[model samples]
Structures are given as structure tokens and as C-alpha cells.
Target chain A: AQSVTQPDIHITVSEGASLELRCNYSYGATPYLFWYVQSPGQGLQLLLKYFSGDTLVQGIKGFEAEFKRSQSSFNLRKPSVHWSDAAEYFCGGDNQGGKLIFGQGTELSVKP
Target chain B: DVKVTQSSRYLVKRTGEKVFLECVQDMDHENMFWYRQDPGLGLRLIYFSYDVKMKEKGDIPEGYSVSREKKERFSLILESASTNQTSMYLCASSYPDSYQPQHFGDGTRLSIL
Candidate 1:
């Protein structure tokens, strides 16, 4: 079965610090990868997505993700974290089926 | 912006009662999905509809049914509510392309008593 895995359940980082959230997936083929963030009392928003070429994809809110086919990982990263960036992050994959398979999710805490 | 609206932000229902969760999308997307979010299990797709009067079962659709009588509306139905059915339900819509990303609603947090 196709699956996505976000190893970290919760991560804490000080404001202005760099942030990196890891994600891995298992699938028959390298599917379309995506990163979404859900803030408190708000809906989930698409951060970025990787469809084809250019392993490094930039997204909204100063976020970027790199797709590594060798490791089957699509990790999200930010050079500097902000207080408002604290939220729940999810990694997902679409096998060209219009259905998304999402990871459990990582709750990020930005401390000042 | 693509606006996908869920009828309720929160809901409470009694066991054995029929329950309905309504969703509407203004983007005129060809695909709509209903997913249940659980703390450690992530989001599980219950059902999806691609067109008017067309529906398909998702991974965890055993206890749920869906209706899409119109182009912009999709409804999820629980035949008999149960405590285990309590969850954060999310509604999303997207274009027909498999690679198209979906736009979501603010989710309905339903509690079954």
C-alpha cells in the first residue's frame, strides 16, 4: 500500500531559528508530493507541491521542499522561522488519482 | 481564492441518529472529498464525488455514504451515528487532474454522544 510518513510528532524551535521537517513515503512510483499547513482554528493551506523536475520547489509563506527520489523523502525547510509559522504540518502524495495520501502530521512550536 | 465551505464548524449528535455533513465549493471543481481527521491516524478518506450524482468509496467508507445531487454540493451521511464517529471532518475540492492540489474548508468538529 502507498503511505506517507512524518517521523516527528512534535518539534520545538526558537523564533528566528531555521526549521526542517522530515517526511518519507512508500509508493510504486514517485508520486506528486505536497506540503500543507493548518493553523489554529483555520483550514489547511497548501504550502508547496512537487510535480516533476526541479527537485527544489518553493512555496508560499517562505517555505520550500526538496524531493529526493533516492531516499523517497520530500522534506520541508525554512531558513528562518517566525512565531506565526507555528502550526501543524502535513506531507502528502498523489498517485495521479486525484486522491491524496497524507502523513500523520508534525506539530511545530515556535518559541520566543 | 477557491472557497470550500462546510456547513458547520462544530456539531453534536446522539447515537443511532442519522447525520449529515454538507459541503459546498465555489470553484466549480470536478472532484470533492470527505475525510476524517484523527490524532495519530492522520486523515482518512471516507468518500468522494467527481460529478453530479456520481460518488465513489474511499479507503474508510464502510460506515459512511455520500451524495452529490448538484455540481457544487457534496454531502456525507452517517446512517447511524456512533461515539467512534466523533472526529474532525474536512471537505475539499479540486480539479479533475490527478496532480491538482485540493482546497479545503475550515473543517467540522463533530462529537457523537
Candidate 2:
């Protein structure tokens, strides 16, 4: 079965500090990876996705993710953190036709 | 901007009552999806439609049914509402034959009494 793993359940980073959220997946073929962010009481917003080519993909809100096939990892990164960026981050793998297998999600808390 | 709209932002239904959650997308997307969001569980796919009148079950499809009479609209129906079914229901749409990102609505927070 295809599955996504976000190792961290919760991560806290100080404002102005760099942030990195780890994600790994297990799939048989080349995978389509995505990162989504959900604010409190709101629907998820797409942060970025990696389908093919360009191992490093940029996304909205100054977020970028690097797809490392050898490592089976797609980690989201940002140069600086802001309090507004505090939200739940989810990593998912697409199974065609818009079907997504999502990780348990990592709750990010941006501290002052 | 691609807009996906849900019929309601919040809803309350009694147990054993029938419930309907409607979603519409305006981007002429060929694919539409329904998912439930819960704390710690992230998002779980319930059902999806690739075309008009064509539906497919996702990871979790138990106790739920879907209808897609039109290309831009997808409706999720709960035969019998239960407390466990109370969740944030999200609707999304995406284009076919492309890696385009799925656009989402604000989501409907449903509560079962």
C-alpha cells in the first residue's frame, strides 16, 4: 500500500528562524509529491508539488520543497519563519485522478 | 483564480438524519474530490469523480455515497448521520491529464447531534 510519513508530529520554530518539515513516502513507481497547508478552521491550500523534473520546486508563501528520489523524501523548507505561518502542514502522494494519500500531518507552532 | 465552493460553511444535523454536502467548481476541472479533515489525521479521501456521472471510491468510502450529475458539481450524501461523521468536509477540483494543483473551498464544518 502507498503511504506517506511525516516523522514529526509537532514542530516549533522561533520567528525569523529557518524551518524545515520532513516527509518521506513509499511507492512502487515514480511518485507525485505535494505539500499542503491548513490554517485554523480553513481548508487546505497547496504549498507546492513535485511531479517530474526540477528536483527543487517553489511554491506560494515563500515555501519550496526538494524532491530527493534516492532518499524517498520531499522536505519543505523556508528561509525565515513568521507567526502567520503557524499552521498544520501535510505531505501527500497523488494516486491519479486527484486521489491523494496524506500523511498524519505536522502541527507547526511559530514562536515569538 | 480557480474557485471551489461548498454549499455551506457549517451545518448541524441530528443523528439518523440524512445529510447532503454540495460542492461546485468553476474552473471546468475534469476531476472533483471529497475529503474529511480531522485533528492529527490530516485529510482522508472519501470519494471522487473523474467525469460527469463517474465516481470512484477512495481510501475510505464506507457509509457515504456521492453524486455527480454535472461536471462542475459533486455532492456527498450520508445515508444516516452519526456523531463520528462530524468533521470538516472539504471539496476540491483539478484538471485531468495534468499535474495541476487541486483547488479547495473553505470547507464545511458539519456537526452531528
Candidate 3:
């Protein structure tokens, strides 16, 4: 069975500051990793995904993640975060049939 | 763009009432999934359908049942609503062979009283 862990439950960052959300997964083989964001009362939006390729994958809204197989981590990062970026972010690993094992999610609070 | 539609945005049901949550995807994807979202728990899969009339139990499927009557429609059923079952329900659809992202609906927030 595959599982994902996000240690940070909540993170607060000032506007224009760099931010990183940690994510680690336990999977037997090469895993498909994804980052998704959800605003209050809204559905989740895909930030980015890593199937196989470059270690660093860029995503929407100035977000990027690096897949580190050695660390079993795919952490999301942004150089600058805006107030609109305040939302809950989730990291997930894809199992067979595209079933996703999601982390507990990290709620990001961007202060102005 | 893939459009997954959940039938309700908000629902209020009494305990012990039978509840049905409907989902429809327009992309003709081969896989559809039902998940429940709660604060601090993220999203937990309730059930999924790989093909029409084929269902599979997910990580948390004990309190829920699912049906996939058509290729584009998948439904989640609660035989008897309970307070613990009250949560935001989400429906998503994805292709079988493609690594394409799962498209989600706006979600239905069900409250059991």
C-alpha cells in the first residue's frame, strides 16, 4: 500500500516571501506525484504533477516541485506568495487505476 | 476541459435518512472516484469505479456504497446517514491509461443532523 505524509499542518508566510511545503511518500516503485490546491468551499485544482522526467517540475501559479527519489519527497515551492495563494495544499501519490493517496494537507496562510 | 459535476452543493439530511449523491463527468473518462473531505483529514477515497457497473472499495468505504450505472455517471449512496458521515463530498474523473490529471467537481457539502 502507498501512503503520503505532510508533516506541516499549517504554515504562515508573509507576502513576497519564499515558501516550501514538505511532502513525503512511501511507494514501492517509481511513483506519480502531484500537488493540488483548494480554496475554501471550492474544489481542488491541480498545481503540478511529476510522472517521470526532470526532477524539477513547474506548475501553475508560479509553483514548482522537485522529486527527490532518495528522500522520498516532492516538496512544493514558490519564490513569492501572494495573498490569493492562501489555501490548503495537498500532496498525493498515484497508485494503480489513478487512485491517489493524499497527504493530510498543509494549510497555507499568506499575510499581507 | 473535463467537467465533473456533483448534483448538490449543499445538503441537509437527518440521521438515518437515505442519501444519494450523484456525479456526472462529461469527458467520458473510464475511472470515477468518490471522496470525502474533512478538516485535518484531507481527502479520503470512499469508493471508485473503473468501468461501468464495476466498483472497488477505497481506503474508507465501510459507511458508503457506490454505483456506476453508465459510463459517465457515478453515484455514491449512504444507506443510513450518520453524523460522522457529514462531510464535503467530492467527485473526480480520470482516464484509465493516461496520466492525465483527475478533474473534480465543486463538491457537495452534506450535513447530517
Candidate 4:
């Protein structure tokens, strides 16, 4: 079965610190990848997506993710964290065309 | 910009009552979907409609029915609401072509009493 796994259930980082959220996917072949963030009482917003090309993709709000084929991972990263960056992040994609399978999600906390 | 809109942000209903959730897309997307979002389960697909009157069962479709009378509107219906059904419901739409990023609505936080 195809599935997305977020290794870290919760991660806390001080404001301005570098951040990384780990994600691993299970599939028979190369899969699609995406990163999304959900704020409190809001819907999931697309941050970045990886389809076929370059392993690294940039997304909105200064977020980026790299797809590592060897490790079956697509980890999200940011150089510096901001207070507004605190939100639940989900990793998904690589399903039947547009069908997306999302991970359990990692809750990010940015402390000042 | 692609815009998907859900009818309710929060809904409260008694157990055994029928429930309706409406979703509309302004981008004329050919595909629309309903998903249930829970604390640890993430987003589970409920139902999807590719076109008007055409629907498919997603990962979790039991106790739920969908309607797509028009090309841009999709509706999710719960046969009977239950306390266990309380969840955040999300609506999304995308182009029929491959790899289209789905646009999501703000979501509806449903509560069953």
C-alpha cells in the first residue's frame, strides 16, 4: 500500500533557528511529493511539490523540500524559522495521478 | 487563483440526523473531493466526483454519499450523523490532468452531539 510517514510527530524550534521536518514514503516506484502547512482553524495550504524534475523544490513562505530517491524520503526544510511558521505540516503526494495520500503530520512550534 | 469554498466552517448536529456539506469551486476544476481530517489519522478521502453525476468511492466512503449535479459543485451527505463522526471536513478541487495541485477550502469543523 502507498503511504506517507512523518517521523517527527512534534518539533519545537526557537525563532530564527533552522528547521527540518522529516518525511518518508512507501511505494513500489518513484512517487510524487508535496509539503503543506495548516494553521489553527485553517485548511491545508500547499507549500511545495515534487513531481519528476529537480530533487529540490521551493515553496511559499520560504519553505523547501528535497526528494531523496535512495532513502524514499522527502524532507521539508527552512533556513530560519519565524513565529508565524508554527503550524502543522503534512507531507503527501505520489498517488493515482492527483489522488494524494497525506501523512500523520508534524506539529511545528516556534518559540521566541 | 483557484478557489474552493465550503459552506460551513463549523456545524453541530444531533446524532442520527442527516447532514449535508456543500463545496463549490470557482476554477471550473473537473475533479472535486471530500476528506475527513482527524487528530492522528490525517486526511482520509471520503468521496470524489470526476464530473457531474459521476462519483467514486475513496478510501473511506462508508456512511457517506456524494452529489455533483453541476460541474463545479460537489456535495457530501452523511446518511446519519454519529458522535464518532465529529471531525474537520475538507473540500478540494483540481484539474483533470495529472499532477495538478488541488486547491482546498478552509474546511468545516463538524460536531455530532
For all candidates, the clash counts are 0, 0, 0, 1
- Ranking of predictions according to lDDT: 1, 3, 2, 4
Docking class of 4: medium
lDDT tens digits by residue: candidate 4, B5-42: 99999999999999999999999888899999998888
Number of the top-ranking candidate, with DockQ as the measure: 1
What is the Cα-based lDDT of residue B42 in candidate 3? 88
**Residue A41 lDDT (model 4):** 93
Pairs in clash, predicted candidate 1: none
Task: State in Å the error of residue A19, model 4.
Answer: 0.5
Q: What TM-score would chain A of each candidate receive against the reference chain A?
A: 0.98, 0.97, 0.97, 0.97
The 10-residue segment with the lowest total lDDT in model 2 chain B? B95-104
Question: If candidate 4 were superposed on the true structure by all CA atoms, what would the RMSD be?
Answer: 0.9
Q: After superposition, how far is residue B107 of candidate 1 from its true place, in Å?
A: 0.3
Q: What does candidate 2's lDDT look like per residue over B2-101, in tens digits?
A: 9999999999999999999999999999999999988778789999889999999987899899999999999999999999999999999998754677
TM-score for each candidate, following the candidate numbering = 0.98, 0.97, 0.98, 0.98
Worst 10 contiguous positions by lDDT, candidate 1 chain A? A36-45
* Candidates in descending DockQ order: 1, 4, 3, 2
How close to the true structure is residue A79 of candidate 2, measured as C-alpha lDDT?
A: 99
Candidate lDDT values, in order: 0.94, 0.92, 0.93, 0.91
Better of 2 and 4 by lDDT: 2
Query: How would you encode candidate 2's per-residue C-alpha lDDT over A24-97 as one tens digit per residue?
Result: 99888767889999998788899999999999999999999999989999999999999999999999887554
- List model 4 lDDT by residue over A15-47, tens digit each: 999999999999888777888899999988999
Model 1 TM-score, 2 decimals: 0.98
